[model samples]
Target: MWKKTQPLSHEDIVAIYDVLLGRRPESESVIENYRRMGSAAAVVRAIGQSGEFAGRRMSSPFHHYHASFDAQEVMRRHAAPRLEPRDGHLTNFLGVVIHSKFLPGILGDRAGQVEDIPIPANWHADIAEWGAALRAVELARDSFTMAELGCGWGCWMNNTGVAARRLGLKPHLIGVEGDPGHIAFAREACASNGFAEDEVTLFHGIAAAAPGTALFPRQKTSGMEWGLEPIFNATEEERRRALAAGSHDELPMIPLDEVIGDRERLDLLHVDIQGGEADLVDSCIDVLSRRVAYMVIGTHSRQIEGRLMDSLLGAGWNLEMERPAIIRLSEGAPLTLVDGVQGWRNTAR
Candidate 1:
């Protein structure tokens, strides 16, 4: 009777069949629940908006996009001792103000990265997770050095150093930025944090790729925030809000190969240059291929998702673990960045 008196359209019929036959665990049951919940467009749209929606895509809707790459492919692309799931999350979100008043103005003339750094409890949770990861890598390696690419105001570097101290690890810290204002702020952060001279490096301009004419898009409509809007149509005001929270940008314009001497000696690398991962990765092909022990990247490129796994595989690296790039949402619901935490590593390295 149920099959004979169905009102579901041909498209819906085909979709249900596809989900039942070719999709995820308990696809038949999930589809049944969807049917019971009502086959309204609004329902589907709402479901699409939820973080659970992508999980469905990764399951049932995957056939439409990703050709089934086997477990070996998954391992070959994303398997390693990643930096941590919570890397730079707070820094990218709110490190500026936290480090702004605290950072020293006279940098390159100070000692350890910084002191007297403060963070809220919630923010500190993320900081703690990331800091612990950084320390683990630093302790495991010899002569640890880090480059904060596109580092604005040195907030990420400064907050990280302070957080590291809390975690009881002190590796060499550097702030690479093109903005003089941020460089000054970073210096202040360092001095305020009580960093001794020679312990911190501040590479002002021309990092890892972008040489001259560093362009920062006014902290509004940044690819980092705006690229996320399509799923939920985030406006420019939110960019302003994030900017107000201090997420300025100065992409690393030089190649790691050209700048750093040895890749093997490098420990943990933190990269947050808006959405410039493609160019950055392309330019630092050797570093991405050689050293790159632990990495945390925030990318919005659809192109990256399609080819990212393959790119890492070709470099002989594998994606070992990953998690959702959870973004705080307000207007309607929270938006969890789909392509999240693809950690790749090479054991043979």
Candidate 2:
């Protein structure tokens, strides 16, 4: 809904294009480099298009992978494509961001490469079908709230927030990020793009379990800064830490009763916490029993394979697994998604 303003005078135009970032030296250098290399147009183009960073590695110098995984492991295993388009896939999302001129590597990524960094958590909803669902919800509801468990670079979060609003709902967005630096990036990117800070609540820390509860997990990934994708770094310390943390955040750990405190508050839940959805399920079993009206959970757990399905059925949520990732990547440990992804809202209970 942001109509391009009338063309400005040369002086005014230059003043407007002066993008000043208030964060870090690298951030400033990034902006400066983009200006010097005349890549503003290129950057904008990348942001406006979907999967623009498809093959781009996140970390420059190609050392991010070496920081964790072996070179052979990187090429052989993670190099294989694990993604396929789905319902909510935003074809021109990156394009939109570029048009908005706010894509300066908002995620923890040093560069805007998708591969070197990881896919932001909310990117799980990037399926084409998910896009349709989002549009449908926008057409159906007057307003809605969209919160991301771990919003990376704020691209997905910012894009979806705009979509939610465009869908006609008064968007109430909560982006819970562990790293304050990334949180600041998210805050700036969204605010610079004509969005009010109030529309998006960018938290500098993790979302507390409830009022007084604090999750004591170890790892926190901000999201993808790709280009050199297929992130494979066997020697990376982060990978070691990730391995050490285990199923706590990056693995499947929680039961159902713990995560879902509000049974009917969340209209749509997008859980892309590595493999932590299982733990969330394990923690807030009842949440699956009630709270969420629609969901787009990314499965990484094989033990509770049918856990989400069972909980949804028990709660009377008739959802069909839309994109089954037809090509099985993992031995039954593939990424599964849902669509029409809705739950019954009972007012007479």
Candidate 3:
């Protein structure tokens, strides 16, 4: 339905190279070289054929042509462990090797698909998604505040830190997780990944509408995959009954404003609070409108997804991307609900 109007001018080609490479051409001679190549396509081929781009291992994952972001240095930092590059997956996963310079790395566990770690099956999709997220933050600001609610193992935090550092920005990162054990693990992971105490901070509480107690499912001793954990806004009697039954753990639920008091501006916020996304967004709409420039929230239900879409759009945030989850009800039944990550950027403010 759509087609290119005309060949891109030399200036246009150079601009594209600048955005993809994150830097201007070395000299005017580079532009002249591209000009001598004739068409835009030829210029692109000439650039790809150059030794500098060739050394970067130019790869066009979705196309036949090879393209490079000039991110070899960052990619080397995310080299797969020895156990990886095998048939299946690694038992002890360390970090993800994303080829996009926008996101340098993602520290996560391979035992289970915890964070966006590259796998033998979905490594390309993983790299594209994580890289897009980091690119969103990069476009929003060079240096600014960032926070991750439900910061599972601090994978996104590390990714943000690494990307920001490469961009010459010293960003302050905050990690908030309701899981006590996860909070400890996240702290250690952050420290191990070169984050100093002053550069990164951790909060051990669930982010809710207000400061109060919320019922969280206590992790079982054997497994740690509670990606669908929910926080209930239950009555005191209900809370007591759950505690008496020894099923749920009582955790302090604090609002984002309280935890991030007086931050002034939050450039980006990544929230994956399992099923609590809708309630948390509703409860902290004011704080979000005031401080947050961009938000990427993971939803678990159609109702939650609609609520978030309405609330953020009403507050002047624009939807940037959405990846919906699909699951079958039974062996032969149709998929029931759609839920996944939704990205929004505040375009008005």
> Among these predicted structures, which one has the highest TM-score?
3
> What would the C-alpha RMSD of candidate 3 be, to one decimal place?
16.4
Candidate 3 deviant stretches above 4 angstroms:
1-129, 140-142, 330-339
Worst 10 residues of 2 by lDDT: 60-69
Superposed model 2: Cα runs more than 4 Å off: 1-95, 98-129, 132-136, 207-264, 288-290, 301-305, 325-349
lDDT of each: 0.42, 0.38, 0.56
Which of the predicted structures, 1 or 3, would earn the higher TM-score when compared with the native?
3
TM-score for all models, in order of appearance: 0.49, 0.47, 0.62
RMSD (CA, angstroms), candidate 2 = 17.2
User: Global CA lDDT of candidate 1, please?
Assistant: 0.42
Query: Which runs of model 1 end up more than 4 angstroms from their true locations?
Result: 1-97, 100-139, 159-170, 210-214, 217-252, 262-264, 301-303, 325-340
Sorted by TM-score (best first), the order is 3, 1, 2
Q: On residues 139-250, what C-alpha lDDT tens digit does candidate 3 reach at each position?
A: 5565756888877566577666766665677778888776676676667666755678898888877777777777877655411332535456788888888899987888
lDDT, candidate 2, 1-349, per-residue tens:
0001122223222322332111122444544543432222232222323353333323211121111112222222222233222221222332223211223233223222223212211222323233423432432355666555555446545655655665456766556554444566677757644577667765544332333322323324322221111112234566556558662233222222223333335555554444344445555555444555555554433434366656556656554333222112225443221111222222212
The candidate maximizing lDDT is 3
Candidate 2 vs. true structure, TM-score: 0.47
RMSD of each: 15.3, 17.2, 16.4
